[model samples]
Target: MPLEQIRPSHIHQYQNFLEKRELSSTTVRIYLTLIKVICLCINNSSYNLYFSMYSYKR
Candidate 1:
């Protein structure tokens, strides 16, 4: 699924799915944190690229 399309509900669903799979709470939290970090990285990179382009055009 596209990162842009991920929603809070989807994350919640993923947590529930992880629980259903009997994964440890710590593992689930780690997974979620990784996902958040990845999303942040993507968002930051996109913002930086846009800013660079805008600055170049100035």
Candidate 2:
């Protein structure tokens, strides 16, 4: 699924799926944290790229 299409509901559903699979709580939390970090990195990169382009146009 596209990152832009992902929502809080999707994350919650993922957590529920993980729990249903019997994954340990620690493992589920780690997975969620990694997802959040990856999203943050991608968002920051996009912001930086946009800023660079805007600055170049100035």
Candidate 3:
């Protein structure tokens, strides 16, 4: 998927992916943080707060 289609919750799923791959929590947080910043940049809006993967899994 395009990076633009990615949202904050996608970052969480990515964290879960990292976990399943035995990545560290700190690493997960770092990746999520970067993804969050990128998503904000792409959206060109800072109104987004962190979102849970469950919220958008539908």
Candidate 4:
């Protein structure tokens, strides 16, 4: 999917995909954290920090 087409649902789907692969919890956490870090690094978006892992997990 293109960057411009990404939505919250897509993120959820990707998370599900990872789970379906039977990855370890540690691996999943690391991948998700990397994504968050990428987002933070890209825009320095203060608003995003307000929504933490709890928000994403659901």
User: Among these predicted structures, which one has the highest lDDT?
Assistant: 2
Candidate 4 lDDT by residue in tens digits, 1-58: 5555768788788789999999998888888888777766556655565655337562
- Prediction 3 TM-score vs. true: 0.56
| Cα error of candidate 1 at position 4, Å | 1.7
After superposition, the stretches of candidate 3 with alpha carbons farther than 4 Å from their true spots are 3-9, 45-58
Better of 1 and 4 by TM-score: 1
Count clashing residue pairs per candidate: 0, 0, 0, 0
| TM-score per candidate, chains pooled | 0.71, 0.74, 0.56, 0.63
What ranges in model 4 sit over 4 Å off? 1-4, 45-58
Residue ranges of candidate 2 with Cα displaced over 4 Å: 46-58
The better candidate by lDDT, 3 or 4, is 4
Cα lDDT of model 3 by residue, 1-58, tens digit? 9975766687677788999998888987888787767666667634343343224763
Give all candidates' CA lDDT scores.
0.87, 0.90, 0.71, 0.75
Considering TM-score, where higher is better, how would the candidates rank from best to worst?
A: 2, 1, 4, 3
In angstroms, give how far residue 29 of model 2 lies from its true place.
0.2
Better of 1 and 4 by lDDT: 1
Query: Pick by TM-score: which candidate is best?
Result: 2
Q: What's the residue-level lDDT of 22 in candidate 3?
A: 89
